[model samples]
Target: MTLVARIRALPADLDDLAGAAAAEGFGMLGVLAREWVAGTQRFAMPEEALFAARDGAGVLLGIGGVTRDPWAPALRMRRFYVRPPARGRGIGRALVAAALDHARGAGAAMVRLRAPAAAARFWEGCGFRPIDDPTATHGLEWPGRG
Candidate 1:
């Protein structure tokens, strides 16, 4: 399936995607949903926040997005999800690639994200190494793995 990403500026079609992502093995899905709602509201009223994802046949197959960062030249990939029906097909991996491309265009120097322990091995296959920092969490680096 084709993967794409768009701005979270409208948030008109995210509630469903959030629910689907929550069903995955990711533990931070709850927090991600809460933040997405808040960010969606903010994005609607403001112009700073951004969200992007991959849509397949009018359904959210994958999700990856970022908010405006004033602190540094980096984008925190707040959430990444692949629907159950869309899993095991490398959709998650494609979505991550799309998200990283978006972040780079937003003038971000680095992109950070969290992956569930269950998916850690998968991310490793994506070339992400665990950092020494406790707060660093989980993420896969690009062009290093695969």
Candidate 2:
């Protein structure tokens, strides 16, 4: 089935988004669960946005978000999770594209994400390069930035 993506606003979206993240082992440590709860609360702010991918039937297939970086003049991509059954179908790519578009519209100088090792290649494929840091997050400078 074809998947469509759009900005998400309902609290129910958070439940499904968090559940997808949890199913991907994010709940094992509980940090992501807490972040999902806290992050969604801030989504209405001018600096943040949440998105959901849904099938033609309107069943959610994936979710993600972007927010202004508190520590840098950049946008931070967060909570990107695609259901296992929906992986390999470009949902993640679509989500990242939407987030980057939002960042550019917000005048961000760059975009950053602390992706897990398992997702390193995926983020790289999305045009992010490893940042020189102990934690090894990925970053992408806004296009045309010298």
Candidate 3:
């Protein structure tokens, strides 16, 4: 099993993933980014990201992303997606591992995300706890890293 691959954000990757997002009922990141690109004072910061999982013949299989703000103590899980064919193969678990590693390396005090409600159970299974605070993004948080 190819277990993982790390592809940094490329413009083309953004285009390729639009279909995935739509199919899975997640936000269209390319549309968001394109709109952002068109806005004044908005710039793309190549996010600190990681992707892992198996490819047949020992290629990597997982997909995930993390954002690290150098001066801020927060880490944001930008996105995570596993190809439909790879589901149930532990690829999601592997991707989570890599994303968390990205967080830790970025000196994050905690990791946060606004996962679509459909992914609530999966993310909960990945160890993210729902927060009671309604104001927080998607009302969730990963326990603070010590």
Candidate 4:
């Protein structure tokens, strides 16, 4: 299957986005569902961007975004989730590449994410390393630093 990732405008349906998050065990109907729910305005900036992945038929395969990391001076890759049937198809990698590319273009020195334990391998495979801070859920720093 051919997957295309792009930095398009966010979908108007919050429910759909929430459903995608819920599929990955992230709760849907809550303030903690996704950062965009709480900080919708943050994504308006060009530096803070959102990307969506769709199949040739236009099915939503996955969604991810990059925004200012609240805990540090870095861009945070947020709400990354892929549909069950679309796993292991390089969609996640494509999304991460888009986010990192955006970060680099925005003059960010690093990128970070607090990914779940289930996605540790994926993040590690993408060249993100765990940080030493215990307060972080599970942090990964951008490996390609200047």
Candidate 5:
């Protein structure tokens, strides 16, 4: 109820959310933690960001991030995860929307993501069209792009 998405300044602060994700068989959160700790990635680019969704009580419901694609020109959405109990409540969508807004503010024209097959419908529902690229499974182009 009334989830708010906010940019996270440090990955270490996401330990609880990351642990929950790992328990649910998602490894991206762990990767986020390790990469951040190792200085390999921190979602610190001018056009990149990490967002966490929290309820009124400050409980983390989900987390996600955007970054310049390592293999493409578009910004890439990554490390997205929502707790099982929080699924279907729009928490994930809110996180995605926040990440998109962040990208749009940075003048990005497109966003890409490599979603699992199970999440195809979810991504599509958010306006990301299925793609046949190896580095990305779905993409969303900004409206009015010529």
Candidate 6:
């Protein structure tokens, strides 16, 4: 059966999701947790926000966030991860769509991310193209932004 996920702005809790990500050898989620607890990098900057996807049973399926790039005046997509079991369920794509929509709504003309080598195809499939920029490995410009 296909599962439905509810995507929304992150809440104050994500320990379970962080643990799941660690089990799969992904440490970004743990960093997200620590930074969240420390009151740093909460994605609270203007035009920035974090998103979480939860299954019908309220289990975290994935997470992604957009923030202002520290080195460039552009939006950066970060801390994106989908639980292993939740792969192929459209959860990751949904998270990306949500983040992109948020970025566009906030007046961003483009979005960038440093995708891991293994995730190159996925990011490309999501409309991001590989780039040589130091601040990001891939970028996507909003259509008609010019």
Listed per model in order, the count of residue pairs whose N, CA or C atoms clash below 3 Å is: 3, 0, 16, 0, 0, 0
Report the C-alpha lDDT of model 4 over 1-146, residue by residue, as the tens digit: 65655555555554675676666678622332344456644466777887778878877787777878778877788777777778889999998888888888888877778777888889989888887655354444444654
Let me know the TM-score candidate 4 reaches against the reference structure: 0.79
Q: List candidate 4 stretches off by more than 4 Å.
A: 1-8, 12-17, 28-42, 134-146
Quote the positional error of residue 48 for candidate 2 in Å: 2.0
Where does candidate 3 have its weakest 10-residue lDDT segment? 133-142
lDDT of 3: 0.59
Best lDDT among the predictions, by candidate number: 5
RMSD of 1: 5.1
Candidate 5 residue-wise lDDT at 11: 36
Per-candidate TM equals 0.66, 0.81, 0.67, 0.79, 0.91, 0.88
Worst 10 residues of 1 by lDDT: 41-50
Stretches of candidate 6 above 4 Å error? 1-13, 143-146
Error of 2 at 63 (Å): 0.6
- List, residue by residue over 24-132, the lDDT tens digit for candidate 6: 7889988877787788888888788887787877676788889888877789999998888989988888889988988998898889999889999999999999999
Q: Pick the candidate with the highest TM-score.
A: 5
Candidate 2: regions farther than 4 A off: 1-5, 11-17, 28-41, 134-136, 143-146
Runs of candidate 5 exceeding 4 Å displacement: 11-13
Candidate 1: lDDT of 27?
42
lDDT of 2 by residue, 39-101 (tens): 634456575787778888877887777876666777788778887888999998999998888
Please give the range of 10 consecutive residues that has the lowest summed lDDT in model 4: 28-37
Candidate 1: give the clashing pairs.
Answer: 4-53, 5-53, 8-51
The CA lDDT of each predicted structure is: 0.56, 0.74, 0.59, 0.71, 0.86, 0.82
Per-residue alpha-carbon lDDT of candidate 3 for residues 10-56, written as tens digits (9 for 90 to 100): 34445445566667776645544564467521223443665645577
- Please give the lDDT score at residue 116 for candidate 1: 60
Task: Encode model 1's per-residue lDDT on 13-119: one tens digit a residue.
Answer: 66677676656545444565565567642423232333444555666566655544344344555556666877788777776666566655545555555556776
Residue 112 miss distance in model 2 (angstroms):
0.6
